[model samples]
Target chain A: MSVSDTHRTIDAIWRIESAKLIAVLTRIVRDIGLAEDLAHDALVIALEQWSQNGIPNNPGAWLMTTAKRRAIDLIRRNKLRDQKYSEVARNTDLYTEDDMDHNLDGEIGDDLLRLIFMTCHPVLPQEGRVALTLRLLCGLTTDEIARSFLAAEATIAQRIVRAKRTLRDRDIPFEVPAGEELSDRLSAVLEVIYLMFNEGYSATSGNQWIRPLICQEALRLGRVLAEIVPYEPEVHGLVALMEIQSSRFRTRVNSRGEPVLLMDQNRAEWDQLLIRRGLKALDRSQKLGRPFGPYSLQAAISACHAKAPTAPETDWIRIAALYEALSRVLPSPIVDLNRAVAVSMAFGPDFGLQIVDMLGNESSLKGYHLLPSVRGDLLVKLGRFDEARKEFEHAASMTRNERERELLLKRAAECNSAH
Target chain B: MRFMFIVKATGYSEAGGNYNQKYTDAMIAYKKSLAGAGVLVSAEALHPSSTGIRIMYPSDSEKPEILVGPFLADQELIAEYTLIDVDSEADALNWALRMPVPTGCGEFKIEVRKLKKNLGFLRYSGTCALEADLKDQLSMLKNF
Candidate 1:
C-alpha cells in the first residue's frame, strides 16, 4: 500500500480501536488526559511510520505497544521526576497486548467506566462532561465535537482544553466511586452515555441522520458496562436501549443521507443482530428481579417496534401504557409530550391533542421544537390546515437540524396547500 | 472540596430531553441504575432555553443586561450543572468524566473550581453588591 493508503488504514484502525486503547492506557498510566495524549502520540507515530512499514496485522496491539514505548520514553526524559516515572514504569510491562486483549477485563471495563465517571463528574460542567466523553470514548476529533454542537471549532477546542485543565487542577480520580457517591457519579455517567447514543440516533444539526461511529462506540461501552457490572440492571437497560434504537440505523436515512421518519422506514432495513441483542439485554434487565427501570421500559417499547412486521402493526396502546409507567417512575414534560404521541397513535388525534394542550404551559416544553411539530401533526389530523401550517412553520423555525428543518417546512407547505 | 459538575445545555443537548417511551425509559433506567449503585447525588433535566435568557455584561461594567431566550453561546454552548462532593479533585473529575453529554448532542464542560469558603462574610458584611451579584448569578442557581 502507498503511504496515503497506510495512513488511511491507520486512521480506520484508530477509529475502531482508540476507545479500547485509551481505556487500557488509562488503567496503566492512571491519568485520563495523559492516556488520551499518549494514544494520540501513538497515532502521530503511526501516521509517520505506518506508511513506510505497511499496516500492522494487529493494529490495536501495535498502537498499544508504540504508546507504551512512548510512555516509557516520556518518563525517562523526565527522570528528574523519577518517582513519578517509577510509578508509571512499574505497571508498564504488565500490559502486553494479549493481557489487555484478554486478562485485564476488570480494569479495562473499570477504566472506561472510570473515564466516563471522570468526564461526567460533578466538578466539570455538563458541556465539558459531554465533550470529554466524545473526545475520549468516542474518539471524535475536536472538530467533530464542534460540529456535533453546531458550535465553532475554536469554542469546542477551548471547552475540551478547559475541561482537561479543570480535571487536572482538581485532581479528579481515575476510578469509579463507591457508596452513595457511586450511584451519584454513575447516574452522571449513564446520562452521558445515553446522550451520546441519542445524538447518534438523531443528529440535531448534522447533514447525516445517523452518526454510526458514535452509536457504535456508545453501544460498545454500554455492553462493557453490562458485563462488568452484571448485577446493575440499568447497565443492561442502557445496552438494551442502544441495541434496539440502533437497530433502526439502516432504515433511518436514505442513501443520500436525507431524513427518514419511523412511520416511513422500511422495516426490512432494520438490523436483526442489533434487535436480537437489544431484546436479550432487555430480558436480562428484567431477570434482575426488580421493577423495570426507565431504560428497560424504553427498550421494551422499542421491542414493540422491532417485533412489528409493519408500521400499522405497532402496538400504540401498549407503548402508551409503557409511557404511562415511565411517567409514574419518572415524570417530566418531555415524557408527557411523548405519551401524547402514543395517545394519538392508540386512540385519536383529539385524545393526543388534549394531552398536548395540557402540556402547552409546561415550563420545560416552551421552546422545544418537537412541541410545535407534534402540535402540527395533531392539527393536520383535525383538518385544521391553517393552524397546522403555522405549527409546522414554527417547528421548522425552531429546529436546529437542517434535515429536520426541511422536513418540517415541507410539512408546512403541505399544510398551506391543503388550505 | 465540594465540586459542582455543571451540566451545560446546548440546543442539541436539549433535543433528547423530551423523548418518547423508549428514550425516557432508557434515561430513567440509567438514573435508577446510578441510584442503585449509590452514586447519584441529585440531578434534573432542564427546560428548553426558550424559557430562559442570557444575561451578558452590560456596556456599563457595573450593570448586566438580559437577552431573551436562546442562551447558547455563539462560540460555546453550556447547558446545565451538577454538584458533587468527592474526596479529591481526581474523584470529582473521574465522576464528571463519565457524565453523559446532554442528549449526547453536544459536549459537556466541568469547571472544577472549589466552592468558595463562606467564612462568615455574609454575617460580617450584611449587605454588598458582590454578594448580591453572587446571589443573582451563582448563589441561588441549582444544579440540574
Candidate 2:
C-alpha cells in the first residue's frame, strides 16, 4: 500500500482503538488529560512505524501495549507527577504485553464504562460533559464535533479544554456513580451515546452520509450500559434502537454517498442478526411491563420495518399508533412531523398533507429543508408538477449538506420533467 | 438543536376551506409524535396571508409603515409553522422528510431554519439582538 493508504489505515485504526487505549491508560495514569496525551503518543508512533513496517495483524494490541509502555517511560523519566508513579508502576506490572493483549482482545468494556462516568461527572456542565464524552468515548476530533453541531470550532475547542481542566483539577474519581446518583447521571450518559450513534447513522453535514466507526462506539457503549444496568429498560431500549438502526447502515447511502430513502433501499442488505438482537431487546423492554419510553417507541417503530417482508408490507397503522403514544408521552414538532408521515402511510397522501398543512406556519420549521421536500412529494402525488418542482427547488437551497441537496435537486428535476 | 418548519401560503389555501379527514387524522398523529418526543416547542397555523398585516421598517425609519395582505400574495406566502427541538439538523431533516403532504390543491413549501438557543455566553450577556444577528453563523455564545 502507498504511504497515504497506510496513513488512512492508521487513522481508521486509531479512531477505533483510541478509546480503549486512553481508557486503559487513564486507569494507570489517573488523569484523563495525561492519558489522552499518552494515547496520542502511541498513535504518533503507530503512524511512523506502520508506514514503514506495513500494518500489524493486531493493531489495537500494538497500540495499547505501546501506550502502556509510554506510561511506564513517563513515570521512569519523572515526566509524570509523583502521585501517579505508584499507579503507573502497578499498571506496568499488571499489564504485561501478554496481559494487555488479552484484555484489549476481550473485556475492555469496564474501563470504557469508568471512562464514560468520569467524563460525564456532574462536576462539568451538561454541554461540557457532552463535548468531552464525544471527544473521549467516540474519539471524534474537535473539528468533527463542531461540524456536527454547527457550532464554532473555537467554541467547541474551548468547551473541551475547560471540561478536561475541570475534570483534572477536581480530581474526579474514575468509577461509575451508584444508586440515586446513578439514575440522575445515567440520562446524560444515554444522551451522549444517542448523539454519537446518530452522528454515525446520519452525519449532520459532511462528505459521507454515515460514519460507521462512531456508531459502533455508541452501540458498544449502549450494550455495555445495558449489561451493567440490566434492570434499566431505557438502556435496553437504546441498545435496541441502535441495533435496529445500524442494521440498515449498509443500505443508507450509495457508493457515491448519496442518501437513499428507506423504501428505496435494498432491504436484503439489512443485517438479520442485528434485527433479531434488536427485537430481543424490545421484548425485554416490553417484559419490563412498563409503558414505552421515547427510545423504546422508536425501536418499536423500527421493529415494524424490520419485520416487514417488503416496504409495502410495513405496518404503518401500528407505527402510527405507536407514534401517537410517543407524542402523547413526549410531544415535539419533529415527532408530530414523523406522525404525519405515519398517518400518511397508514391513510393516504392527502391525509398526510392535512397533518402537515397545519404545520406550514410552524416557526421552527420555516428554515427546514425536508419540510419542503415532503411537501413537494405530496404535490407530485396531487399532479401539481410545477408547484412540486418549486418546493423541491426551495428544499434544495436550504440544506448545507451536499448529498441531501443533490437528492432534492434531483427530485426537482423529476418534478420539472413530469407530464 | 432547534428548528422551525415553515409551510408557505398558496392562493388556493387563502380561500379558506376545511381540510379533509385524511389530512386531519395524519396531522393529529403528526402532532402527537412531536408531543411524544417532548421536542415540540411551539406550533401554529397562520391564517391565510390575507388575514395578516405586514409592517415594513425602512432605512430612514421616519415611521414604521404598514401594508395589508393579498398584495402579491403569490410572491409572499407564509402559511403556517411548527418548531421543534431535535438532536441535530439531520434529525430535524429526518423528521421533515417524513411529514405528510400539507396542501390539498397543487404544491406547498415548508422551510426549516435553526433557532438560536440561549448559549452560555449569550446567557451571561443576555443580548438577544446580537443573538439574532448571529443566528446562522458558527459563532456560538456557549460556555462550558
TM-score of chain B of each: 0.52, 0.73
lDDT of every model, 2 decimals: 0.70, 0.74
lDDT tens readout by residue for model 2, A1-419? 99999988888998889888888888888889899999999999998988898988878888888898888777777745475575558546646556665665335777887898888787877667767887987788988777666666656666676677778888898877787988767777887677667645555233465555556778977887787677778788889988988888778678777656666678899999999999999888888888888778878988998898877787878987987887786676556657666776677768877877887887877887667777777677678889889998998999998987998899889877787
What DockQ does each prediction reach against the true complex? 0.02, 0.01
Poorest lDDT segment (10 consecutive residues) of candidate 2 chain A: A202-211
Q: Which prediction has the highest TM-score against the true structure?
A: 1
Q: Distance from true position, residue A58, model 2, in Å? A: 5.1
lDDT for residue A341 in candidate 2, whole number 0-100:
66
Residue-wise C-alpha lDDT for candidate 1, range B92-143, written one tens digit per residue: 6786666544344444454545566512101111112112212221111111
Residue A379 miss distance in model 1 (angstroms) = 10
Quality class of the docking in candidate 1, CAPRI style: incorrect
Model 1 chain A poorest ten-residue lDDT run: A203-212
Model 2 chain B worst lDDT run, 10 consecutive residues? B135-144
